[model samples]
Target: MRFPRTARLAPPAPAAAGDVLAEAERLHVRLGAREVLRGVDVTARAGEVLALVGPNGAGKSTLLAALAADLRAGAGVVRVHGRPAADWTAPELALRRAVLPQSTALSFPFTVEEVVRMGRAPWAGAAGTDDEAAVAGAMAATEVAEFAARPFSALSGGERARVAFARVLAQHAPLLLLDEPTAALDLRHQELVLRVCRERARAGDAVVVVLHDLGLAAAYAHRVAVLSAGRVAADGPPAEVFTGELLSDVYRQPVEVLAHPRTGAVLVAPRRDP
Candidate 1:
């Protein structure tokens, strides 16, 4: 899980304050008879990682889709870069933001590098020769360079997941929307993915990720938004928002939030039944 120092891109210039990269206000969406998201209001800002955490069926994925502009909201508004998401052309939106869904189904037989190179399509006219560097750097960062020549369909779940992440990294968008980026990874790879998220935020990209792992969310996210029953239960800094009582109530389970003894980082765990 080691990455070469040279593979890391230099941090980009910091974004201006109060610059909202993506925002969803009073967003509502329904699928079939069930309302998936209910009046959810969330904003992702430059240079920050916002982790969306909630139990299953809490509408985390639905909200993420809305933010990515992949799903139309039944009500309210979703804006990216201060403009309505629907107004942006597909190519323009691809350059401004990238999305990694929970799962991808690619029936085409494409090499790993080819799949990663697809991310640069939006910039094909402007990127010139730089696309090679972007693709190589992305593969290196995700530790998928060794599989560049192999067919993407041949890779294992974790390997494919890493390659998929590399595709998003290669996109080089200002805003990133990731849904369950670490779900298919091993423990080490999970940490690696979250570390990549922090690095992206440091590079001035706004990142909003849906994470089921509360501990990972607490450790990496600058802000944590807890969703309960399709509503935002709490939103703030991890240390301030992720309390034992709040998490337990929102998740409808016995959960505990403790401070790490040495690092003072928040630790979340489910309580054992007595």
Candidate 2:
């Protein structure tokens, strides 16, 4: 997977804080005869981590795909970097956004370093690019450098997820769309992943992540979009959106939202019945 260094791609310009990098307005998406997303409106902003959270089959992943322009909008519009999603050529879109799918499967036995290096493929042959630095930085950021030479298929599920994330980081695109990045990780790695998301947002990259863990979303996301039945049930700061009433109803289970005893962070848990 070697890319020529002689080809040049213009990097995306730096984004200002609060700038909307991606947005779906009145969006509708259908897969076969079923509508997976219905009239959803959401935005990913520069310098912010936006988490999409909900119960299973709530359309979190589908909405993420729509934002990434992988799925065509059945109605309304999806915009990336201020232009209609369809307007950007694949190469052009690659320059501005990077996506981490729910799973990463490779038929070939590529090493961790090789996989991470693939992220730089979009910037290949682009002037002033340092592929080595980008790859190394991404691996380090995701804590995957320790296994750089291991075969991708040899790693555990959590390890593979980190490596996949490193690849996305290496792309250095201004917008990031991640699907359940913490799903396979341990407690520590889950925190690590969200910390990296916050770091990216701080550096002015827009991050939209689909999360099933409400606690992580409460802690890391600058804004939370709670999805239910293919629609945005609530969208706002976690403090405002993650009420016990809302969550209990959306999940169809007894749930509770509490403030951390020591740090005042939001904590969500199921209400145990006596």
Candidate 3:
């Protein structure tokens, strides 16, 4: 289906709590001895949504991992809640941050609610303080409550995405880190998930999402950080960073930057349909 005719508007920054959710300090990352990121500096503050956009293998996912404190930097720092990530206890960190990787693996057959509730595991501790009300609220907010009891694997791709997002919301963290969150879903589901992310940021959470869809990135993110060849190519407002020259330089393909007629947001399209 064609994209729903949305008036390309950047909603005002949602009402949020105090700012300062996360920071990256000259961060560098490597995986299995392969250098993935180089001298990357980034930050996410409450009340705003940040989207990371890049060509394939541009280290988008690596940067997300570093910001989430999943990957240790070789020479820089990742601070969560204004403190070095390593200093926070695992449970404490989990309580204040949440991450949704590109995919989830569930071997056991459990209802959708079960997988989402697992996000609360970080806070539940041994005695399992996972409040039932919190779980229900998260599910409801993510629009997964309708299928809470359905088997996860049995659900469609979009349904599973909603459930996964519901799980992250259950963590109730002030910071959210997501990787390729809308890669597989249709346009409708993509909008649904992005809306949920926007809702959380409006509620005072700091949000950083990795996205391949530049159009969605433009529409939803307050800022867009473009990465190329393991370094930040450009980082600023979408219209400023998504220039015709920058887009061509980063992707090595001619592209057009169109100003949306309604929201005034910038939309990127390939110069050649191919």
Candidate 4:
């Protein structure tokens, strides 16, 4: 799996819909003695939501971190915007991508608005940046504007998750790497978050998200990459990749993949009846 190496710091051409924003080619990553990813290949494309789905220990988060340049790939390469991820400086990477980790914990007491505004720091002193509008718009979109002044430390788990997501939206980067954005949300907020992901993709941003919920991945993701034992078991549209046999085998449980009676949306659930 040899890849042509692009020059460091080369100017990337203007990206459009269907363009690849980030990708992992023959990527392998190790954490201490444990190899988390092995020979994995995946891509995040503009105007699409690509979801990483698998059971625990499937290397989903490790792959996302590698693509974000937070983790070094031991064997292969991670490319972002036409160059190796290692070539980009932290500030440069911040301008091109925004990341949301699984945990949204703030040690200090900061207001919701203040926490959201922290996302704009990367754009400060840059010409033509409307900080206030970005902040307000993000808050409104995440439905957190009403509690803008409340302390982040005082918010509930779900509220904190939404506020953290508002911060990512405020960053306004072309690529978004989100790890379990819907894990802490209720039904309505979960739907809201996926809707926003779809909106971002429709607006020509590339979104890569790690989702534990198979139903959510089936319902909202434009494509699904099903991982198993540190490799991609299958990757394709939900209707194609999410068959019961594959999912059941990957998850190590008897599972059922069904379609909604009216809307024909894909549905996944563990098999309970003997």
- Give me the candidate number with maximum lDDT: 2
Name the lDDT of candidate 4: 0.91
lDDT of 3 by residue, 167-234 (tens): 88887777899998888788887998888888878878888999999899988898889999888889
Candidate 2 minimal-lDDT segment of 10 residues: 1-10
Listed in order, each prediction's TM-score against the native is 0.93, 0.98, 0.88, 0.94
Superposition TM-score, candidate 1 onto the true structure: 0.93
Better of 1 and 3 by lDDT: 1
Residue pairs in candidate 2 whose N, alpha carbon or C atoms collide under 3 angstroms: 5-125, 7-125, 8-126
lDDT of each: 0.89, 0.95, 0.82, 0.91
In angstroms, give how far residue 236 of model 2 lies from its true place: 0.7
Clashing residue pairs found in predicted model 4: none
Count backbone clashes in candidate 4: 0
Error of 1 at 157 (Å): 0.6
TM-score ranking from best candidate downward? 2, 4, 1, 3
Task: Compare candidates 1 and 2 on lDDT and give the better one.
Answer: 2
Each model's number of backbone clashes?
Answer: 0, 3, 1, 0
The parts of candidate 3 lying over 4 Å away from their true place are: 1-18, 125-130
